[model samples]
Target: MTPVNPESSTLYVQSLATGVQVLRAFNTQRASMSLPEIASAVGISKSAAQRFAFTLEALGMLKKDSQSKRYSLSSANLESGYQYLQCHPLLERANPYLLDLNQRTGETVNLAEPADDCMVYIGRFSSLARLIAHVPIGQRIPMFCASTGRAYLSSLSDDAAREILERSDRVRYTPQTVTDVDALLTLVQQAREEGFACCHDQFYRGDLALAVPIWDAAGNAVAGLNLSVSSTSFTVKRAINKFVPLMLETARLISTTPPNPTALRPFRTEPRGPKEAG
Candidate 1:
């Protein structure tokens, strides 16, 4: 006959839950986390957090800090994500198309997906001029402040889209940033009708971006494709008229293409180093 201790059982459960929460905090933002930082953010006891973190470290899922004695995520998570991408034939096919668009347009082109209340640029090609990328790959940008985000939101149900808007603080990145929830909702509806979204100095300070949703065979846009140009390069009307159509065509080509057979990868699945993490 065996009996379990109630207090011990509760302790084990809290430890497990706290460990997962600790891991969640290591996204694109603030990738590397110190023990104290993690404990504060997870709102867990220091001893409990340390035990959980050491467990993850033993599992080869967290790298320890020597000087600061903190911790960061390891590379093991990338294998799981890479395996999932291997199954998604669409993302592979879409790559060559993205590359071609970059070559032809002479501007940066990006593909993004909804993440929390924002959109993360999953794939992108850079232009001749270097840009200040405040939101890098695996990072998030607000739905109201990014044309790519708005394009993705515009394709979703109104109730669902409105919920995202309501949750976001709509921090004013620039004077052009749309912080009004009602007005942002209206803009999303208009994007749906126009089949694209355009915004100037919204997501980026000097960048003007035109984004459109890429519809799959099932008629759902699982992601948004965006063409971005600096204000110095062109005006809004010219970008819409000259580049929008090409962008749509390139999206379809990439969307319909076959999965990559090679293993070369660029996306980040684990916590990034301090230098790259914003």
Candidate 2:
């Protein structure tokens, strides 16, 4: 969990934070939950959960099932997300390039930005061809296992990367996931050497991803650009040989100018669940 800076603690509103947490309790895995479940998930009392749920429902951010009393995120929640995408300067600049790459590769293209120890998918362009799965915007993948995560880490100092790796839970999601901090650091080093990162079936079965970090004019790593392909469609060598150049070129084009430092931010109030991390 990311806490506000101690210096700004006086400015933080606990109620507002808790309200956002209540909304975040719903996800692809847990699409709908009961009041008791919400209370348990948010670490609040049942009455508190009920009040928040009631308020959210009234505000149209959440909807309650009349029969089951289960609450789920409403369409109104998309307003904030849509507004963010529309207003983000970096996203605005990257969309054309991302679309070009999507058309060129006919594969999944994503732009992910770091949020604490995770990388959140802020931009996603789906493949025209057959897809194994669909990952929506706002998806958070652990920095320890995701190719995008590793790519972003490669751009950071070794000590900075190690600190985040240590803070991670490091749960092995698949046979290919490198949970050991030393092993993971080695992968980051390899990315630094190769100028990109690759992962094969680390977070999802039959999913292979290659990523490169996006940098600003000042040389700060601001985001990661990645393309995901099905294992059935291409081997690691084929993917690297074919897509790496395209990925690098696209990233370079998008990084021509720096964007607002605060343009990209995470929307979640908590860390993503195991299945959600890739």
Candidate 3:
């Protein structure tokens, strides 16, 4: 039966849908909502909402504020959303460009989005390897250490980047990983100036990933496009001379699109070959 009040339907009963919906209800503004507030926001009974929140927290979907006993969403939701957009039309507008890029660069072309504290590889065009770097589509890389992460981070506001960095673990992934906050801040500044970011073996062992940011109509870096090669195939110099320009071209094409994101198609994966690390 329809609710007597339309507002009530949006504000109340629909809140009772599932654990997922309840988890989604938490956002930046509602960061630390109390159990009762969550119940009202999702239109669920206090007991049931608390149960769902507890379950979500157990699963790392929600975090309970130790001080206030409120709840907020964990980074897992961001990962799920990134994976969804990766395969959808969100990357469609960029597929042809990526394919051309892969052919021209003769390397794996990857599209990524800011997922949790890292830029997760979403779309991939593989050649010479079944998939480059053995990085699954859901794999997470450190924002400060990966070229894709830096490219997007450079496009974000200073405060936003620092906030995320401060909230993250900032663990040392490799000897090359820039775990120093001050140094990363400086690198971010350089990336903003140069219009792209490059990292060699920072995100993964002996992996070279170069990336540029794709902006939305709002001028926000909504996505990142990258070319990844193993330490055996291309040198940092070769990536810059041969691949950077085309990668930037793809980024520009995608950034110039209307508000909606474009989708990019995936090619083939091949065996890892010999190349120099960038």
Candidate 4:
């Protein structure tokens, strides 16, 4: 769980924040945990962890094993995410475009938005071909290594992109992951000039991806649209030559359409640390 601000606004509910923290403790890696483990992971007392666990269970967001007493997230927990996706007009508007791109390229396509120092996948369309990486919706990848992240950064000024990179953890996920800030800045600059970003096996060993930034009517880069293929099938240059034009066209279409005001809320950045690359 992320630490809370000590000098937060008076309206802030610390208890509710803590409860949410407890819920976030469950992830793909640690799917289930005992009270003591949760307490340790969340930096809370065992009693506090117990209360939060029980409350979440009662709220139908979590489930506990009767025999082992280990807690795991319940299917009901996905309802919140489902509701967000259902109401998000950006995803609704971009779905057909992403689907078309996926069908045409026969590769995984994704829509992501910047959140602090990373890009979070909000929508995805998988290819008919075998997937090189299985990145689910809501998965976060560092800005320094992901094509979507670099594409989003390309929409910003160099100074602004540098600030984000400075705050990032900058962990080298693979041999191709560029941890050097200067090298990453060069990549972002190239993307800025080229109108798109392309990465080969940076985050995933066998994945090649290209991305273009999606802008709002006001010209702010509100999101990134990406197309990813297996490295074994196509070289990075070939993928870019094939799909970058299509991605740019889709981005232009989304930009011209007025976005639903309420749908923009979830894309807003919140304070959080970077996640280890998948």
Cα RMSD to the true fold for all candidates: 10.6, 7.8, 11.4, 7.7
> TM-scores of all models?
0.78, 0.85, 0.63, 0.88
* CA lDDT of every candidate: 0.73, 0.84, 0.72, 0.81
- Report the C-alpha lDDT of model 2 over 39-130, residue by residue, as the tens digit: 99999999999999999999999999999989999999899889998999889899999999999999999999999999999998999786
Clashing pairs in 4: none
Candidate 2 local lDDT, residue 114: 95
Question: Candidate 3 — what's its lDDT?
Answer: 0.72
By TM-score, the best candidate is: 4
Model 1 regions more than 4 Å off: 1-17, 26-34, 75-87, 130-135, 255-278
Lowest-scoring 10 consecutive residues by lDDT in candidate 1? 259-268
Top candidate when judged by lDDT against the true structure: 2
- The residue pairs that clash in candidate 2, if any, are none
Tens digit per residue, CA lDDT, model 3, 1-278: 75767655556654345786787677667777898998898888999888989888998988888998988888887877676766676478878888888887678888888877888777778866534467666667778777888888887777887777777788877766667677777767656766767777776776777787887867678778888887666666666667666776677777765322222212112222222121
**Candidate 1 — what's its lDDT?**
0.73
Candidate 4 vs. true structure, TM-score: 0.88
Please provide, for model 4 over 117-146, each residue's C-alpha lDDT reduced to its tens digit, 9 standing for 90 to 100: 999999999987688878999999998899
Relative to the true structure, candidate 1 reaches a TM of 0.78
